[model samples]
Target: MWRDLLPIGRHRGSGGYRRFAWTAADTDCRAWFKAQAEARGLSFELDRNGNQWAWLGDPLAGDAVVTGSHLDSVPDGGAFDGPLGVVSSFAALDELRRRGAEFARPLAITNFGDEEGARFGLACVGSRLAAGQLTVDKAHELRDADGVSLPEAMERAGQDPGTIGPDPERLARIGAFVELHVEQGRALDLSGDPVGIASAIWPHGRWRFDFHGEANHAGTTSLEDRRDPMLSYAATVLAARQQARLAGALATFGKIAVEPNGVNAIPSLVRGWLDSRAADQGTLDTVIAGIEAAAHEHADRDGIDLSITRESFTPVVEFQHALRDELAKLLGGAIPVLGTGAGHDAGILSASAPTAMLFVRNPTGISHSPAEYAAEDDCVAGVVALADVLEGLACR
Candidate 1:
């Protein structure tokens, strides 16, 4: 069903979509969401933190049922990560309405901002700020590669910077949250299932490593004299792979940049962003330590200085037991249950409210790339499962 919707706001010209938060494309997706919600007679409102909420019943202050996902993406992320939940949210609402299902508590769908960390580099920015899990000063201090602060960026987009944190009143409004998303990994395909309920979210964090080396002329510098940061970075990358494999955790040197990137010169100051995830905090720490050891060793060998910065850290989280049990019963106890390595706004929101997630199978076992995929039948199936869960939660 989304194949037709795929190309609507897709970007990077043959790569994929670029709906980073607060940008034109992201705003366009919001417009699309508003149109869909309006068709269902839902009302849209902006909370203090700028998270968009579309309500489905009479306005009440406390504990409303909520569903939906972020609309932001990495530069070339696939179509399904964030928007799937938003669209399928409407789809599920439509399905329930057709079934004549009614709710005692109000229901709303939310579009959390900057879930991708693509534009802001902090995961689940909106939800974290709204929930008070993160400080507003830290939120305002977050900077992009080009040095634009989040506060300045928000002001540029017509949103108030002072209103960006810990909306206790807003947090109190949500009773439960369920996000439907594409499986970012191969868990579901191996189970041979079209849909599964999430069991837990793996512990994950982001670290930035800075390597400083001499910048010198390629022709004049001898091999022994050249202190190339790129060489140290390459060594660190290899060490990260080896250490993670040895520790049985997932570590990636996914994003890297070198200053003065000239082919004719030995580069100075290569940077690496390491994303390490594992089943628990211990393993995550082990993996990170291993990478740091690699950095120290390489820095000494290459005659470079190194520094590490922690961008964000999220511990593993378990879904609410009673709510998950209710969903399991609705699915006939046949639905697959699995843990995800990927992070989401729901994961951040789960601490304060009952939160759960539904994952659609991806045949390719790929995500965050152009090749990430989900079959149409599987998408419709996700909508069905979500509708079923919503029905149980709303009418109960």
Candidate 2:
């Protein structure tokens, strides 16, 4: 699966991938998904919200036992983050076919769009819209860094921008949704296990902080006379680290932009985004509030204007225990239950369906970057694990 996808969206310089949603590369990936499904004699259907579903039997016959994940990647992100779940879905189907397994209920593999929010600044755009969490009007208004509106992007992809919205009928068709993904962290490595069941997702959010200052010639601006917003941003970054450590949460100012970004000119504005997560909402809120307060203080003292906005927030997601237990029982009694710090479409879909996840071990304990990796053997284990769970759910 990885080899087949290596050529698509390959970043030659960094050896990572840039499969941002709605782009030509992403479109190629969707085509690949359709081809793979059709080769196996499956019927493919694309929902109103742009999510693709490949069915092994009649989709409308019964509530479907759905599996699969997104294909989009963060800029220069690792190979396994989104695509792992997708290929694993196909691999599981291959395993079932090899065994000649028969199914009673409908089974479908899905590819969700824009799960990373890397392009449009809203994670789970496809799932959120399908689940009725985000309205079409608001979604159409979203803009990317290049100032391309969501509606325009949809139009570029041959979709009606006006038709993007919650699909209650489609959402109702999912009996249970399962996703198999590479472990984004080292919990599995620490436990000496190759696979595990996801128990919950930590609450997480993104905040944008924009600081205003004067742009001046670097040679002409004196240290004492300069009101540089970058200083406040730097201070906020440090405060984020400290507050997260103190509160036992995770906070990172990973994305930033500086206006008038020439080396010879002082930046006029600094826009930085904070990504934070915690075991509970209270700790997450406290850590964020602390960082915000410290940033405000720094901005005031430095004579810099500051503004902050909550771009998105997802509360802690606890998977339905019955589904989790059922999957564990199917996989085997000894499969470990785990919780993840990273967010996923499965986490978003949990609100609308009985959702669970299977995670393959990642020796690198890293994600969202090129260094993330999973051994081939572990990936195959994930495929078999998923097939077992699906058979238990749909093949009775």
Error of 2 at 136 (Å): 1.2
In model 1, state the lDDT of residue 182: 91
Which candidate gets the maximum TM-score versus the true structure?
2
lDDT of each: 0.86, 0.92
Question: Candidate 2: where are CA atoms >4 Å away?
Answer: none
Which stretch of 10 consecutive residues in model 2 shows the poorest summed lDDT?
1-10
Q: Give the per-residue lDDT digits (tens) of candidate 1, residues 59-162.
A: 46576889999877887888888888888988888899899987878899989988998877888998999889889889878888788888887787778888
Q: Write the per-residue lDDT of candidate 2 for residues 247-321, one digit (tens) a residue.
A: 988999989999989999988999999999999999998999999999999999999999999999999999999
Q: Which pairs clash in the backbone of model 1?
A: none
Candidate 1: C-alpha lDDT? 0.86
TM-score of 1: 0.96
Error of 2 at 302 (Å): 0.8
